[model samples]
Target: MKDINLTKEEKADAIEAIKSYFFNEKDEEITDLSASLLLDFILKQIGPLIYNQALKDTHYFMTGQLEDLFSLEKHVQRK
Candidate 1:
């Protein structure tokens, strides 16, 4: 799989969120570099699993819609 790339804004936002989580939940303050490293690790290790699961969910939903469409088809009578 290709590497997951985030926009600069998104990366910055994520890093901030990470910092906030650590501060709020763990009562620890982390540097921007530390949060960035954690974000990179999550993207590298967990991103693909989440992406694949989303694809599977979309496929399943589309298959169900297609079956419903096929069921709506009308048969024509021949002489």
Candidate 2:
């Protein structure tokens, strides 16, 4: 399985981007603190749901289940 490693700066940037995108004022109108709560909900709930596909891909490779599918498409031909 490929290691899921994020550098410190990448992690920090993602956090800040989420905060600004969800919570900051839009078109001069301020949103409520629900922005923060919504971000929290998404990170806790939706994030994992989205990551599940990656988990499946990784699991298959780690367990040798991807051999057939991966081998079906030859890298030499693609190049």
Candidate 3:
């Protein structure tokens, strides 16, 4: 998977959320720059794993749907 790039707006939103979480959960404050750096670090470290898992989940779901569709077709043929 390509680097998980976010739009400018999304980056800003995520940074804000991280800043808020630190304040709310840890009673610590973070600057916008710090939040952004943290976000980038987290994404770089975990994004590939997350992306691969999502692909696997999607493949599994689609395969099940396909199996269900074939089963339905067989049932219809018997009617």
Q: Write the per-residue lDDT of candidate 3 for residues 1-79, one digit (tens) a residue.
A: 5788899999999999999999999999999999999999989997888888999999999999998887766434553
Q: Candidate 2: TM-score?
A: 0.40
**Per-residue lDDT of 1-79 in model 2, one digit per residue for the tens?**
3334457676555656655765564533323455445556766777777688878888978779656667788566553
Q: Tell me which of candidates 1 and 3 scores higher on TM-score.
A: 1
Where does candidate 3 stray beyond 4 Å?
A: 74-79
Assess candidate 3 and give its lDDT: 0.92
| lDDT, model 3, position 3 | 86
Could you tell me the TM-score of candidate 3?
0.86
lDDT to native, each model = 0.97, 0.61, 0.92
Error of 1 at 48 (Å): 0.7
lDDT of 2: 0.61
Worst 10 residues of 1 by lDDT: 65-74
- Candidate 1 total steric clashes: 0
Best by TM-score: 1
* Ranking of all candidate structures by their lDDT, best first: 1, 3, 2
